[model samples]
Target chain A: MLDSESPTKSPMKTGESATRATTRDRLAAASLWLPVVILSVTATLWSRRLPAELPVEWLGNEGGAFRSTAVFSGITGTFALFAAVAGIIALAGVAATIRPWLVLVAGMVGGSATAAWLVAAGFGLAGEPMPASAVPWMVALVLAAASYGVVPYLLSSRQRRVRLGDAAAGVPLGVGEAGAWFTTIRVRVFGVFAAVSTLAAAVIAVLLVPRDAVGASAAIVALLLVAAGFLVFSRLRVSVDHRGLRVVSSLFRFPIAHVELNRIVSARSAELRAAEWGGWGYRVMPGRTAIVVSGRRGILVERDNGTHFAVTVPNPDLPVALLTTLVSR
Target chain B: MLYKVDPASAVTIADQLAVQVRVAVADGSLAPGTRLPPARELANALSINMHTVLRAYAQLRDDGILEMRQGRGASVRADAAAGTVRLVELADALLAEARKLGVGIPDVLILIQKRGTHA
Candidate 1:
């Protein structure tokens, strides 16, 4: 269990702050146009060296092969796809409304697609025969990019501690003492819909695809989607005790927010509209993060570090009061 | 901070909420100028009528322990500490005396008013 009295404030030293600022600036600059610049330079150089027409071969599954002469070089199509991906990434970086998950997903898919295309073009340009299958390489690149995005988020969320045994122990009923209150909000409608849809898609993919490496890959993707949907639609359980506020998932018991009583500056009831939060499950914005479900009434908590968190629940007052009382104590 | 209200208790829900707030203020859990939660939201969480929360807030406001403004909501008064201590003492004494003399709250109120006018 995490000590409730641990320091919540993370004031940066001058040197560290400056270093972080510089790093952020560099990242922002790179995100804006680095990919596009690299793609443009490669395209310009390759276009000048490539022939106007190239022979392309297509190998069919039933032992049939065909060759066709392209009007434009193969590099042209590869460069075009690369440019589109770069443009999308740059735009997403600049747009405030685009969710980080959307950007991450796009980056994974687009980055892998561009990488595969570039590799194929490189082989063609070198007068070497193209690989029979690029599926495995693309899949590996996609997985790598996805892990890069997801692992950090998962690690950060795990930092919030949820001590079920300690929390339960802290709530003994006594005269003039407040006992722990626990409530679970099951998102049944969304959970059922998402689980059923993903499962059905996985079944369809398994049945429709031919029994080959490509078919196996499609089936794996569908299974992953099913797992993701289940995680997304799991029930949210909240508990308040002397230790502080704890919000965890019912299915996995992963900590969403476990704000210590000492770290809480204040809490109050809020009316959270999905529109304001950009239609959220978990929304990360400029200065605040929120966990939104169905209800408009929610609890907004301000921590000692000046970060704000909001969670939509049917009853927000009890937690607000509990937090206020604990902070006061 | 934990606040609990039992629906089955003999004490009214509004009174329970008021007592909790008063105890918090008196014990220095709620510092001066600290804002309280909105009545509607509190009521919703407690599953009680909104008016019950408003009544508790009004009681606190009348006691000079809280200051309620139009848009700013409720907050503990800057001088609430001294006032709260005095109020708690007087409340204890009055309740003891009323119980000892078998006198109701209304009779005690009437007696205090009459004595105030004469003084």
Candidate 2:
């Protein structure tokens, strides 16, 4: 399964220090999201009352029905925007072996812009202008909170060990030995986000949706719900271990693959498909197509016996380099 | 002694370093504790990315073949000489060269001995 030699181990002292620093940086980056969530919740709860006190008068009454329904939809849209931005910032923070500072900068810019847009949209829908001075501060808070949350997650979840072995013919495989704890925590967190976002969308649809347009609202809400669900699933992650690739999801658990590297033909990313590749959770590209589940890039393996394995991955460059090294050896 | 590195090798900078270090150590050209260039300087000298050099150093360290300190740079480890790959191709090439030159095996051995003693 592997070379006759024992696999190398990272230095204890240096590895610990590097892991700690990485964790600290990720936490700093993730903290940028706190303000965003807080502001969103606060805006949703108090905006109706707050709108009355604004310097600018609220425009057309449009009656209570229109006002209530419009406000509810706007808030849901705002939440969606916030969640998307948060997800982007979090992913960007830990995408590769990027410098902490660079991730921080990217998170701040991305999170703040999206938040600002959301706030502006909210203001327009409410027929009011945003408080100019307050907006930037709110955005800054969101940025800081996001850094704090994301940096630690990155640090704690960093892959520490790997297990090298031969995968079956025609299966592109990676086995990581240690660091399951990190991967577990990550999966749990994403699960929480998914569940929360999904529940929020569901609850809002049930409570605020008008009675007359039940059919239409049901369709709209269902679409939004699906998008929210997929958004959460897309962020799920699992680590490669010696036994196989550990698959962690809110719904189920299993080892995704235990294939060999030599069998892999080519790897690439593709959109989710249900029937051909088992409904979109995370699929190995079937047939001639190696489909990566949610990641932008995937590794594809075509065995000599006409079977295939494909896995969605974050940074194809590093894994690709590692694969090349192994294959050449 | 300085060795030239090919600019367009398919090998990564770290891989190149590992290969060079392994060969040099096996040949006794670079002795243990011999200080090497800083990662930054080596990256600059080779015109490769800094992270590439860092990854190489990390790999070497992981293998217990290289020692790196924050400001002290890198050096050969104390116990790196145990592992070596004997190449039949080089031995055959040398034997063929000696026969072509009409040199006896003992004379070839003596010349090799002289070069080693002088170095």
TM-score, one value per model: 0.41, 0.24
**TM-score between model 2 and native:** 0.24
- DockQ of candidate model 1: 0.06
Candidate 1 chain B minimal-lDDT segment of 10 residues: B37-46
Top of the candidates by lDDT: 1
The numbered model that scores best in DockQ is 1
Q: Tell me chain A's TM-score in each of the predictions.
A: 0.46, 0.28
lDDT of 1 at A274: 65
Candidate 2 chain A, run of 10 with poorest lDDT: A176-185
Q: Give lDDT for model 2.
A: 0.45
Q: State the C-alpha RMSD over the true interface residues for candidate 2, after superposing those residues.
A: 19.1
Please state the interface RMSD for every predicted structure, separated by commas: 9.3, 19.1
